[model samples]
Target: MLLWNPDMNWIRNPFPPAVLALILAGCSVAPVYERPQADVPAAFKEAKGDAAAAGNADWKPAEPADGIARGPWWHVFGDATLDGLEERAMAANQDLQAAAARLAQSRALQQDARAGLFPRVDAGVGPTRQRPSPASQGRPDDGPSQASTLWRAQLSVSYEADLFGRVASSVNAAEADAERSEALFESVRLALQGDVAQAYFLVRELDAVQALYRRTVALREQALKLAQRRFEEGDIAELDVARARAELATARSESLGTARARASAEHALAILLGAAPADFTLAEMPLVRSAPPVPALLPSALLERRPDIAAAERAMAAANARIGMARAAFFPRLDITAGLGTEASQFDNLARWSSRTFLFGPLVGTMLTLPIFDGGRRDAALDLARARYEEDVAAYRQTVLTAFREVEDNLANLRILAQQAAAQDEAVAASLRASQLSQTQYREGSVSYLEVIDADRNVLQQQRAAMQMDGERARSTVALIRALGGGWQAPEPVASASPRR
Candidate 1:
């Protein structure tokens, strides 16, 4: 038998009236969210200065050709060994793999969170065999204790009515987080590329320096021989010969240190590529080539293009949604529950209509929170979210500023280093001429053997200095490219094709 109270009104919906009530009640407290905005700068500090020097022209539109212009940036050095190392680094880099895994996990969790917006269904079946007690049991025990098997099967379904759109908001928030994770993965990937490239360049530079040191050692040995001959012939003092011997020995000692430094650089590169040092070798350093110009980037476009900045912005969005979710807690939640089942004392009869039973109902739960002073936890949460939003904003701005600084620093370094390199090359040329002239003068007995030795030493130092400057220019260019986010673009939509993977 079923009963309805006289005072209650009948609701014709398949969903119970309580469900509708829950949804209606929630309509009052659902949080309305608006995105917070801080002013975006029109130009980056460094770019402004650069533009001022270049006649303040409008930022050039990025060309598709520009993407293909820089051929792997590192390849400019024309080293096949470096290309192989980079390939290995990308394949086995531990941190990059971790970041990729994290992104995948986030995507899975996003899907899971989104599922809460839909209904849940479950099923169960059980059979029990028991004997009724004769004394304690009811009328069924009148005929003595009886053994029987009871069979039951049921299917249940329940779904939240999303009264305050809490589930929707939460799902959206999770999706944003997943996107943020993906961006973070990209950021990590860029960083890894930069590290590997820089490490490789450093190793190559060490090779160049050590090779130069070996040549210096040889030159010093020659100078020592010349000094000894001159002193034996009574053309120079013993002190001059001793000085030459000491300088030669010092150069040899310095060569030993440079060799060690070079070995360490190679070993570090090996680790970066996940290989044992003994298992790999890099090609000799070729003539160093200057890196391409640092492409100009507009400040307004940088945040959108930079993966880390985008990730930060997405983080702010997720936090904002969380605030909405918390506020939605003050409202009511509507739930619909239904169960269909059959039960029978005999296994054979479990499927019969007479054994069938079903239940369908709607539940409404209003939080009805009594704020009766609980140390302001709810208010604290709101404040925390707001604070986090502000923090993200500040971090975003700081990242932008830092990005500008890096570009500027590298740009200035490249410019200044170029000048220094030009000067060093000139010095090397001058030193070489001086050495030649001193040799001629020595042959003519017009200058001491010490003058030729000094000229040769200066030439070696100048040559090494020039090589070091070349390496600096190359490394700085790489840094600038990385700081600009490797020229990556946001995935664009394609017509008649599936969305991004």
Candidate 2:
């Protein structure tokens, strides 16, 4: 009872045009998303007396991050060598490159998800051969074989209407995934830069230690020469000369140990710079005596500043989007399909308009699927999505808490190290003065060589301690900067008020 109507437009275009328009504003089954709250303090607990506030605006809990490009934070130290190392790390670090590649993958996936919002079209040309049975031909038992090649050319199209927001939810999830990947890439870059600066400082600190040992070795040699000359003059015993020689040997041994440590530190720094140890050499440079002051930002701003926290928050959003995607499976899904083509027994007739064929829409064609039963599959999937969202929520909160802890830990380190460095400086000065007094007393024969030796040992130990404390202070300052999202400037000195009349 089917009749061909050349003028029937509905038979050619089965998909309702209104569905396409509605898809843009499709109803999504996903739950409304909100950033889970965390316990963020107004000021860092460890930003006590030594730290100054960054004077940033008050808290923004769930505002999307502006970005992670905080500028070249390592420049605060004013070291050209460190600045160069950081530049090389950003350009060639393997981990950073890997993170970039992962980000690209996430963006590509987002593109794939966006594709679901539109229809698919395919074109093809092929040949078909078939023989019909006697019953199919409505003929006697000995029907003739109707085997023949049918040349066909076709253009087929299919589209899934976003009736219940399945496609929309998928698109939202993909967008969130891409954002999270970008944030993770930034996190890796910040960590890499921090590593380079910290490693460079550690190497320089060892250089200072080596220099201290060298000075001690030279001083011991000088003392040994003086003890030998005094022994020849019959002013000091052979025992005194032996003691001086022992001191010289001990200093040389310590010097070699320090040299070994420096070599290891240098090798490690070379790897961080993405170079072979044999090809890298650092001309010795002592750690700077003073650490630059780094001001602290308030805890509220720290949330916005750290890339890891931003990434965690985005993960929560992606999980929330997926929950909606799972819920959409419970609703009806619409698929629209259509095909237009030409077929003829002979290849020469396939191009003729009379041989045109077309198919569209329902009756095992365009389908609207309603899941009447699937045992517990849909229920399990919905539950799984919800659980994932909760897990990401916990992860996001933990990241925030960890960031706060890191900031406080580094702040405390810098403050305490500053005080320790000052005290160590005074000890070095006092020890040097005591050594000089002991030497004068021994040359005048007012004291034995034992007192002179003991005094010299104290001077060497105190000076080395001072050098170590200096390195610790500098390294702690770098750590604080990293915890504060890899960069912060010292507060400008308050300008003096204009002279009152």
Candidate 3:
């Protein structure tokens, strides 16, 4: 029933005339991004007494070249030990390496999605053999044989043309996801830096405690000597000598405990830095005298600086693209295919111009898919995408709120710890004065040896407390920096800002 009419135009290039027009109209279906409103309170729940009032807007914004360093924020600590640890971790830490690999995978997937927006082509050439089936009848009774050999070559081209913009929308979604993964990797790196610094401070604190114990033990030995002399002279009971011995024994035990704690901290630091424990050793670092002041940055700045917030925002964009892609699926799709080739019954004539053959067609095949008969699958997908977008929006807001709360928490801690350290210093001084007075009175037979023993014990305990607070305040300061995304050195200081491809 099919007839070929030579005068009828059976082949036409669809892309040059019709498809290009459609593609220009349907380049992308994805909606442009508008940031969702954050539902957070005006101020953080834990923010107190001028903490929320302090912001970068109140301080001087840096010059274009004066912002925080983009890489290696830990350098601000000015400690060589910390710098070396971060370097080792970046090269060898397993968690960081895994995050980097995931980022690469996402980039590759984005490229794959981008490839779908373009035409595809293939070429091939080979010897071909054809055989007519015995049951198939044509001019077979006089035909050559069961099989015939020929030379063949062909080039085929196919293109989807993306007349509905579905392909472009998908590409947008993929690109956003890739950006999110990179942000996540940066987040992991920042968190690891904070952990290493905390562990390092803990080790040094133990060293200080052990040193304190050694001095206390020496004082105890002198007290024991005085107590024994008094017992021999029948001036005091043997109980005082026994008490002195017990105090010395307790000091020795405390020293042992401090050493054990320091060793454990060292091992933990080694694992974090991705090095063997045997190869990593830090000479005792003195406790820092004071914690750093909390850097001033506004609530809006927190959203820009934190990597988790960046990742969450990107996830929202990807979800929005899915909605456009799903909506576009309801429309029709058009594709075009073409082929050119050379064929010959004889090998010598295969490449000759006379043997060339070509075929092209403007195939207007349209897919008309309706959701009327589905088991609600299309609706479910749309619903899921919307729900995910809502969730991501909520998560983004929560991340911002948490960042503000953490900054305030550390600020209060730093404030109170400073006062505690000052008060403990006074306590230690007073204890020293009491011990000196008691020693003089005992030598003059004005008071019992018990007063001297009590005074020395009080002094030792107060000094230990002061040393521990110094380390705690230092650790808290590091936490504040991490919470504020490492000293506000803006790599990209605005939300939704992205690098051009």
The candidate that wins on lDDT is: 2
- What does the lDDT come to for candidate 3? 0.74
Candidate 3 global TM-score? 0.84
Question: What are the per-residue Cα lDDT tens digits for candidate 1 across 1-501?
Answer: 112233434423554677457665654233454444546667544553332244212123353221122225455445677677777887887777788788888888899988997899999988988886876676554657768888988788988777777787788789879878877876776677678888888877777888888888887788789889988999878987887888888888877887788788878888888788899677666336555555556655555556777687778778777777766665545566777788888778878877886666633443232244547776787777768767876876777677667766776776677677778889999999998999899868898767877887888788878877877877886787676666433233421111123
User: What TM-score would every model get versus the actual structure?
Assistant: 0.81, 0.89, 0.84
Error (Å) of candidate 2 at residue 400 is: 0.6
Badly placed stretches (over 4 Å) of model 2 are 1-4, 7-25, 53-68, 131-144, 362-366, 488-501
**Candidate 1 clash total?**
0
Query: Tens-digit lDDT track for model 2 on 425-456?
Result: 89889998999999999989999999999999
Candidate 3, poorest ten consecutive residues by summed lDDT: 58-67
Local error of candidate 3 at 349, Å?
Answer: 4.7
| Whole-model Cα lDDT of every candidate shown, in order | 0.69, 0.80, 0.74
Model 2 residue 24 lDDT?
Answer: 47
For residues 1-501, write the lDDT of model 3, one tens digit per residue.
112235546444324556467656755555677888775445444445333344542123443221233456665566787788877887788888788888888999999999887788889887878897654655556665478888877777877667667887889899989988877876787788889888888887887887888888887888789889989999888987998899889889988988888999999999888888899888886666655455545556667767777788888898888887876665666665666778877778878887786656443434322335467776787777778888888887887677777877887777678778889999989999999999899888898777877888888889889889988987887887777776544454421222222
